[model samples]
Target: MSNAKRALQTEDLTKIEVFSDPQLSPDGNFYSYVSTKANDKDDYNSQLFVQSLNGDTPVQWTFGDVKNSNLRYSPDGKKAVFQSTRSGLPQLWLLPTEGGEARQLTTFKNGASNPTWSKDGKFIFFHASLDKDDDIQNQKEASKEERQKEQEDKKKQPLIVNRLKYKSDSSGFHDNKRVQLISLNLESNTFTQLTNNDADHGFQDVSPDGKQVLFAANLNENADYELSNDLFLLDLQSKEYKKLTDGNGGYHSASFSPSGDKVVSFGDEYEYAGATLTEIYVFDLASGERTCLSKSWDMQLGDLMIGDTRMGQSETGPVWSKDESSLFFIATDYGATGLYKVSLNKELTTLYKEDNHVFGFSYDQDKEAFVLGISSATNPCDFYYLKNDGTLTKLTKSNDAFLNEVAIAEPETLSVKAEDGKEIQGWLLKPYGFTEGKKYPFVLEIHGGPHAMYGQTFFFEMQLLAAKGYVVLYTNPRGSHGYGQEFVDACRSDYGGGDYKDLMTAVDYVLENYSFIDEDRLGVTGGSYGGFMTNWIVGHTNRFKAAVTQRSISNWLSFYGVSDIGFFFNKWEHGLNLLDDPAKLWEISPLRYAENVETPLLILHGELDFRCPVEQGEQLFITLKHLRKEVEFVRFPGANHELSRSGKPAMRQERLNHICRWFEEYL
Candidate 1:
């Protein structure tokens, strides 16, 4: 195939679309969701669209240059409440379901997000950090002055803050003040602060009756150990709060049942030395008892999924049917992650199973139907509906026009045994217009999280590489979630050992089994922990001809003081404090072995990335340059660790283009 034709066929990365946050109307006549589309500017813009069950052109509920997300329909289905930054900072907005102008609800300088409507539809509750009273502002200014004085006193003073945690990924700099829940009265135009404590409260869900609120909070005095967030209940009538679960381990996503007699939540009781597997639990309010629903079911399919698609585990709680007889949830099992339905009486049945992953879903108990958002290695997310009799119908064809103009590669599932004889799972994508005998250059892509799993989801970077005529191989190694707690925790204190070996084994298996792979022209690249592994791989061996590391940790010694999670992560993974044993930390750092790197490398990072920090990339780039090695550095302005997922749309596109360009030039 000609290069232009090949490019047209394989360059489907720009055409891929993502859909999320599906909400079914109360009457089950309409559904609303957030659909992200790429514009002429090559930037992704999110808008809210509502459509009927009979498949019609969706009515655009929102229009603007800004992104709209987190759409939720009120109980009466007369209006919709969502969080948007269209007015600059993210705040709550109320829009009529029948199509009308949206009105701003909350006004806060810091920001407002995660808006949930009360059961009675009389008030809207949200979380915000707008407690800047006069005394608090004065204290903050005094603290800033003290820090400036300390910095001026020493020529080379280390970066230190009085806060418990130095940095967070998206929102840098930890403040001591707590995050409170506030409810806004629509009629009175007044706000009432709900929880008035110093502790942080989040993941709130209002009960069906609107008389009580279910949420997760850390009530302990020790802020350091606040990682053990637990489920709590707040009485709106009496203005009292009570703990529902013991705060021994972290708990989140507390949702109420249809009858409001029980609450369902997910968290790890104790696994992998407190890493938390995020199993499902159902709490009976009247009996004051909690039952582990996930444990009762066969775990042979693996750990249950929890949380939304953006953060936390990909698995979420089961949505209770209208009558509270059956629960529908999503899980990754039997090689693919899809939606499942579990009967409260004890029978488990698979509702809908597809080749791709189901990120988020909503069910309408009144109609006995559900609207789901599903995606796979080759297909971007799209909307679908499952009827009561098990009939599946496609709702929206958002990418039909884009997909017709671009050639896309299909991903094939591949499995290999690790060095220790454990089974590993992964997928491989061949270049568009691939031939049978011709050998093609290959790239091994690693995923971040050291705890996150790369499942059957459409990834833009992987497709972009395939379009450039490179075979893309990605896998969930030993430390990845979705398998089990023990498997994910195995990488702790052994960052460069088993995980590195598993990746190498995957590479060897592909080269040996696939005849179309070229061994001489090999490249490796990854971000975060994957980036850390790429650095480690290059330092230990010179097999790869080229490498690219994004937001990686080069030297643990420097990272201990720079990155936001440096102090805690170093201890959690290495099991050693920075002050006690700096040597062990250094040994695990990728920069310590930079002398062995001979292959050309490109380091990419975001300047505002506090999670891995730009300094980590700088350390690797500067050290490689000083050692007389070929290296290139690319820094994104005002981007954070989420640059690949939800960062600025233009920047995200540039990042993908840069990675593809580097590989095309070097390999």
Candidate 2:
């Protein structure tokens, strides 16, 4: 047989398995995780798996096309609880860790998630949504026929919106259902409502003693207008709770210390609103005093790296050590997310540092080891057993077979000086099967979040572009995380000013340094904030031969009202609301310069996107068409802002095809 490699295709999306949420059993002899993959049914399939440290074959715990995730272990390591959708809506399921059939636990009508076992393993606490007047105890799941009627009834009723933040990109328009807390007694097989309010409560952690539960919420009288996520401690017996943080800031991912007298969390004071760098804090439960642990740490905490393949959420910490002397957590620094530790006195130390993205981790406090979920440019993600002494051992090779059959491109790190002499970091991937002197078309990829960083994560789109013989360049420009607080805060109130210049500078550096790139055949593309930048780039300059913008923002004036967070996002980023200064908002909008666009543009948007509403794309398309400019618009039905990331499987493949077709035609 001839030895050859195949190019990574968009159809391979279903072939690549995504691994996340590695949970080490309390005994340190085993670990469990969730493996997700896009299935042939145009949806995703995620299942739970457990592996032993003694070199036992990994055992698949859950099965089917349904999603079984968020696995949590009991203190005794005899039982595990996880959320699953096998019975229709996602509900808590109990599993016998050793060996037995998994049994359904909760049947709440609105569904249940984020299961946390009580210290004594007698009760399991979870989060669920319910209407204000709806009884939360022993709520039954609605029948299929009832759900169909409910959908039809909802369509007939007019959506009455009275709040500034009513709609969300993920879950369209808001309903009367509010996220509340619930508890299940394993012995009695009974359910009880823990908290009841109009506002939503995010379940955080249960105290070690199990007498109190920790959560995050904004329960102010005017919660509709507030954005603060205050930490709360609720007495499970009395059903009473006390606010832990002042109402001025937002806090989350909180957990009670082993002693239960203190809480450690990640939060910010809304200094820059969404752009504010999240810091670590410890709250003294007795005096209600809060101490900022990472106040002087300039880097952003937690994983802020942007990628299309990661499927599940990871453990964001300050996970306390067995002795409670220090805590370990993930932090984004430079261009990568690494495992780091901070002592009570604020002395920081790096435990597992690498150029790869460490998305999820679980600490085996007894063994002083960790089960880490890591991903990189060539591999999707895999689990590893990491020792405190810096020893690393690969556990499961989720994508090794797939990697051996395909040709993948690795990115080379690059840095350049912006117009104002500020440094910007980025990466360049040369076209696969590249020849030394052959010139290839270049594509500049931008990331959203203006606050999120693009690091050494496996990006399917970037690799696909390289396979098609296009040199790809992606950068973490100003406003991106991982950089210092000053650098991240610099993009706020500036938008297209400095951030745009940083992106342009990155392109210039690549063109100047790389001989294999053809500058005249350059293309540009991005989604969300990156999409806004793509629109701005084409409008401000005619250098790019083609451009594709996905789920973008064109008009700040319209976005202020139509978007779910429009009203506040504008003021936070641009420093002015629509009412504050209409002209200022209009002046910064990309639509204002649509007539100046000369590059052929492809506008891809999800019809159901409420964050950067589909109207944002419609307005731009119409404006460019009216001006007789080169433009085309493609709308994905029933999709949302995450169309490029976790949208439907078929839609995702089609989206990639459109992007490549646009560049191939223009270049």
RMSD of each: 4.9, 1.5
Steric collisions counted per model: 4, 0
Residues 289-348 of candidate 2 have per-residue lDDT tens digits of 888888898889999989999888888587999888889999998889999999989999
Give each model's whole-structure lDDT.
0.77, 0.90
- Model 1, 434-493: lDDT tens digits are 888999999999988787777677676777788878999998888777666567788998
| Candidate 2: segments with Cα more than 4 A from true spot | 1-3
Give the TM-score of each candidate. 0.90, 0.98
Give the least accurate 10-residue stretch of model 1, judged by summed lDDT: 134-143
